[model samples]
Target: MGWISHLCLMNMKRRKTRTFLTILGVVIGVISVVTLLAVGIGVRQEMINTMIDSESICQIRVTGATGGKHKDRMILDQTVKAFQELDDVDSVYPFYELYVTLTNGKYSYDGVITGIPQSELTKKNYTKTSRRTTSNVKPVLVMGDKTASLFYNPDTDQTYDTAEKKKAESWIGKKMDLSFWDSQDSTSVRLEVGAVIDSGEDTYNRDSQSVYCDLDVLKSFLGRLPGGGTVYGQPLDANGNPYKDFVYSGAVVTVDDIDHVDAAVKKLQDMGYTTENEKEYLDTIQKYLKMIQLLLGGIGAIALVVAVIGISNTMTTSVFDRINEIGVLKVLGCDPDELQILFLTEAGIIGAAGGVAGVLLSYGFKGIVDKIAVKMFDLAKGTQIAMIPWELAAGAVVGAILLAICAGYFPARFASKLQPLDAVRNR
Candidate 1:
């Protein structure tokens, strides 16, 4: 080691208790902040994963204004064509939802039905068969996994059991009677069950508890006729006027890349349409996470500030105790810069030691937290509730050392400027 470093070490060794206590203060500060920030990052990531899936991240929902002059803007085919022309848009699919009653000979179900483009539905693993039907038979429809359980056998007066639930999967190839109330008139049609789709584990799936069909088929049954004549079986409204133009409930705009989802949402909002996207939700969540981290960092800063004060006091006391020693060194031609360097090195060693120990302790603490999370919260396997990146570890150590050096700055400067004779007399 260099002579200055050796001297610095010997000085620290002379007051082992003081050095240990000061370092302990810094360690406590670092560990507290690191652990808190780690938890924040972990929770943020887990929430994003749980609440948002790939389908949600890449799609934006647009709905028309209700009870306004421009309420019909989002329902036109021209709007769909315009969305398709947007720079990042991949496709625009019409969205329709309506309450309907479904019945087999022995069972009946009442639920909402949704209509989407068959090609888009297939891409999301909605069904095993991807082929579009060409036959002129009954229109085929897909059923949600939960929609099957909504059926009750009125003849047997029973709901589906475990075994019967499994049998409901075979309903994909059967025929069913579909009926719905269009205003005051009721309409019924025979639909061929093409598939029963599992909507996965998300809390809300557009297909869950709903039947899926081609957009045109659903419109023909539930929407105003092409000639503006009748809506399903309803010939006129309560006022005896022809029905209004058919309008889609909403539109799903698929973006070519997730990075462009926010920009696309902004454009849609500018057109006065209501918009929803997971990206916007995630941005709001991230803001809250940042605030939480800032609060935690402030708490840790208090401890670190106390540690800095302790370090300053210790160095000042050392300068006074070593007045005679410093005088002797000056008499032997020691430079003022060298004297400052020696004292600063001693303080840095203390902070560096604390920082490293703090990092190790933080990791150990993280392991304990993850264990508790797994046991109590039933967090998914391999999900980390505390994440410490390498950047954080390195930053903690470097930051601690710099803080210690700064705390010792005035003390080191005072000692360096002391006159040899005055220091010897004071000692």
Candidate 2:
């Protein structure tokens, strides 16, 4: 073997501890990169899945039209009819909403009241936990759990420290007093709660301190005929009173197959309907993923830069320690190119070793992270963190080698340029 090649091998063996430390530094950096990327990807995928599962895979929301500046009834009717006639359209359900104050003795709260047709419930796939034995025009009302809980346990004091036991007791079978305001007057009604429903979504469930009753009851309570007359262009009562209109906040459209969601959304949109699907959520997630990748990569890059400095420092020290040996080799006719190559090869060896260790450490790091996540969030059961992508792992190995070579360059050049007389005499 050449003198320089033999010397590099001996140097590495002689300083085993330093070599190990350098490898450890690189390992930490690589592990950081892998773990961060994997976790970010996992979180984004999980969020998208949750959103899609809660809503239908392919759904659209349509808002009702309002008369330019004033509330025009005719425009709203025309817009609704236009959408209903679309070629790819499915069945449509309309709703009416009102905000009112409810009171039971001393406890009171303001909540939204919605009027929906029975068929709309089935179309929307709402699970009915309870219902009335008989269907009367104005007898039954369905309420969300949050609304039920409020009436079931009302607060008596300003601090809400004491429970209004009597008020809570009175709400069970009593009709709640609901007051609404008209142009300049107030009207009131009493409605009985027929049943309670539970939907898992916390945001919707909590704010849904909502009461659902039949359209007929809602019309009567609003001081309108069963079939309200067209006040603007909307169907109103015999006295020309307008029906309270509700914009479709959202709709869950079931497709023949899950795979057809994209096609169905396109078809609906082509027919002038707004759609929500995997692509919409996925695009949003991709933006966050890109940000996460940059942040994680930047952090990992800083660590790796530190490791590069360490490598440079280690090589510089090695060259100094072996100055006399380098002088002896130069004296014996070791070429400058040979000396440079030898040092570069040693740097590459260190990088390759670090890369191997780093990849192994990444796998272990991912496992630990997954375990910690499980303990912290108790997310979807049996979810496991994954390792770095193969392409990324390969890139890490190559990048490490390149960084090491760059760090070793100046030190190796310094050694090569040293005169044999100067190196030997100085030591």
Q: Using lDDT as the measure, which candidate wins?
A: 1
Tell me the tens digit of each residue's lDDT in model 1 across 1-427. 3988888888888888988888899899889878887888788877777656566778898987423445445456677888889889988887776677788766788776777765765654554442443123344777776665678887677755332755445676667888774444454677777776666643346556667777666665454433356554323334655446555677899898878998999898888788887788788998998898788778877888888898899899999989999998898999999999988998898889989999999999989988898888876677798889899889989989999999999999999999999988876
Q: How many times do residue backbones clash in model 1?
A: 0
In model 2, what is the error at residue 71, expressed in angstroms? Answer: 8.7
Return model 2's CA RMSD, one decimal: 6.0
Task: Please report, as a residue range, the 10-residue window in candidate 2 with the lowest summed lDDT.
Answer: 159-168
Please report the candidate that would top TM-score against the real structure.
Answer: 1
How does each model score on lDDT?
0.77, 0.63
RMSD of each: 5.0, 6.0
lDDT of 2 by residue, 1-427 (tens): 4655576778898999998898787777777766777777667666666666654444444432333333432223345565456445554444566656776666566656766666644333233433351245453566664553454233433311145322122233446777653323354557676555555544453224566766544544444422234321234434445546533323334454445556667765665445555556666777977798788878878888888888888889888988998898889998887887878878877887787788778878878888888778765557764446688778888888899899899998998898999989977
Give the worst 10-residue stretch by lDDT in candidate 1: 129-138
